[model samples]
Target: MNRPIAVVTGASAGIGEATARALAAEGFHVVLGARRLDLLKGIAAEVDGTAIELDVTSASSVAAFLDAVPKAKVLVNNAGGARGMASVADADEDHWRWMWETNVLGTLRLTKGLLPKLIDSGDGHVVTVTSIAAFEAYDNGSGYTSAKHAQSALHRTLRGELLGQPVRVTEVLPGMVETDFSVNRFDGDTTRAAAVYQGVVPLTADDVADVIAFAVTRPSHVNLDRIELKPRAQASASRVHRG
Candidate 1:
């Protein structure tokens, strides 16, 4: 209760869930946010954190969530996910729009809402969970890659804009992370999701969470701009050493 606050979006699953648990262990009074209040409550209870029903796409929801938490030193933007695997020519525009709204605007909403609290702490940190898709363009990954790329730009621009402020921005880009991400991306096709990681040792939510925690826990004088991580089975967005 005495430690500074750290808020995490999409805290019900995957990297967000892991980040909440890991941040709690790092002495932060973690606040869990997501549309699924039930799931958030479970993780919040386990980590001794606060849970709120936060739909980042809604301005009112984000405002309400922030108004409840007055003090935040860290904010982890992890609310977005990939939607489909169709190439550009066959891609669905709806999916593309959804990705952009969630990944770009959602993060923007929370960051803008919580900036005051974070700055007040005098050691604010914003860690965005982007992906290798942010940097690499692959066939069938155009929409996702576009969204992530925009998200990456947001992180970079924030870093520049907040240079004189107390906040530091960091982007955690992971490759081939084995999470519900694949399943969700494939629209609940469990078999297809399983196949993505079948023959390769992909990174886990815990692994990325570990990196996130490390970046924010550094000496107050040091700011880690970004951290790019991947499993040994992956080389790039298109290169995977599948055995």
Candidate 2:
């Protein structure tokens, strides 16, 4: 039998990179997509997978990536991040717009573009990496949280709409994973980023990757609809132990 294929977005780093590696280890031919071609190439080389230049915010780039990949049995929609930390009143309109573009619109566009292929696979799985912010909001989290909420809603709708179809939709909501997410959101403010998870045992990218792999590897009859993985120190979005 031919090996199953998994396509991972944001494959250049963090959970996306780790998930791609995990899927490959689980005997899936992985297709990595990200804007950083050099990083994507390196990751693909390490995982023995294919790499495609993808900027999720760009429809043409996303279309090109999907066109380049062979039929995929699994799709990891993990290309998203917050842009800045500013209260809604003070938030820059551009930053808010960018967040919506990348976090909400991008996910929808890519998922729609690949829906046909996934449905035709007969045993397809979609694992969307959402965040606790989807359920709980925080100060300066207006734009980011709203986008996540939209993404989660999309997953739920897909699950309900695909009922009886072989396609499985799972949403993974993780809290405080140790990654460049905070740093990037803060525009490389290492101090602020470090403070976000201070004294807290944050989730690792591999932890989320493990869950993603498990979700996709389950037998066709088993569909894990929703998973919430939080660090022990993180009881909720607003409550984090910094001691």
Candidate 3:
């Protein structure tokens, strides 16, 4: 029997990297993808997986990545993040566009590109890492929230379209995960990024990765439609107990 292959995008760090590691530990041949080839290589080495440079926002990049690994038992759509945290009125259109292109369309491209291979895997899973913003809106969260909402919609529609198929679609929504998500959102502003998780116990990359691994590792007869993971200090998108 051959080990299954798992492809994880946005895998340079955080959730994507951790998922690759977890799946590899579970006997899967993991392939890590990200724009940061250097970072991906380090994580890939740690997990004993292959590293491929991938930019989900570009069709060509996605194609290249898919061509390298034409088949996969699992596709973890995790290549995305927020650009900035600003109110709706003062929102930067560029930030909004980046959010949409990276979060929504990025996930869309990979899911569509890999659907056939996933179906052919016999027991396949498409797991998306959305955010708590998908469930609720918050002040200064318009840009990220909009993109996440679209992503949430995409998953729901994919599920409907793929019903009765061999592939399982699962959306994992995480609340306040402490990772490069905030740093990238703040554009390398370590001070600001540090504040987001200060005085609070937010979810970690491993936490989300563990949940995703559990979902995909379940029996073929089981399919986890949607799951939300949050820390006790976080009740909602904006209600973070920073104490």
Best by lDDT: 1
Instruction: Tell me the tens digit of each residue's lDDT in model 3 across 45-123.
Output: 8877899999887999989988999689999999999988899889999999889999999998899889999999988
* Tens digit per residue, CA lDDT, model 1, 1-243: 688899999999999999999999999989999999999999999988899999988889998998899899999999999899898889899999899989999999999888989999999999999998888999888999999999999889998899899898899999998889989999999999999898899999999999999999998778898799999878898888878
- Candidate order by lDDT, decreasing, is 1, 2, 3
Candidate 3 residue-wise lDDT at 115: 90
Once fitted onto the true fold, the runs of candidate 2 whose alpha carbons sit more than 4 angstroms away are none
- Colliding residue pairs in candidate 2: none
**Model 2 per-residue lDDT tens digits across residues 2-121:** 888898999999999999999999999899999999999999999889999999999888888878875878999999999987897898888888988888888898888888888899
Q: Which residue pairs overlap in candidate 1's backbone?
A: none
TM-score of each: 0.98, 0.98, 0.97
What's the ranking of the predictions by TM-score, best on top? 1, 2, 3
Q: How close is candidate 3 to the true structure, as a TM-score?
A: 0.97
Choose 1 or 3, whichever is better by lDDT: 1
Query: Residue pairs in steric clash, candidate 3?
Result: none
Please give the lDDT score at residue 128 for candidate 3.
Answer: 94
Candidate 1 segments exceeding 4 Å error = none
Where is model 2 poorest over a 10-residue stretch in terms of lDDT? 63-72
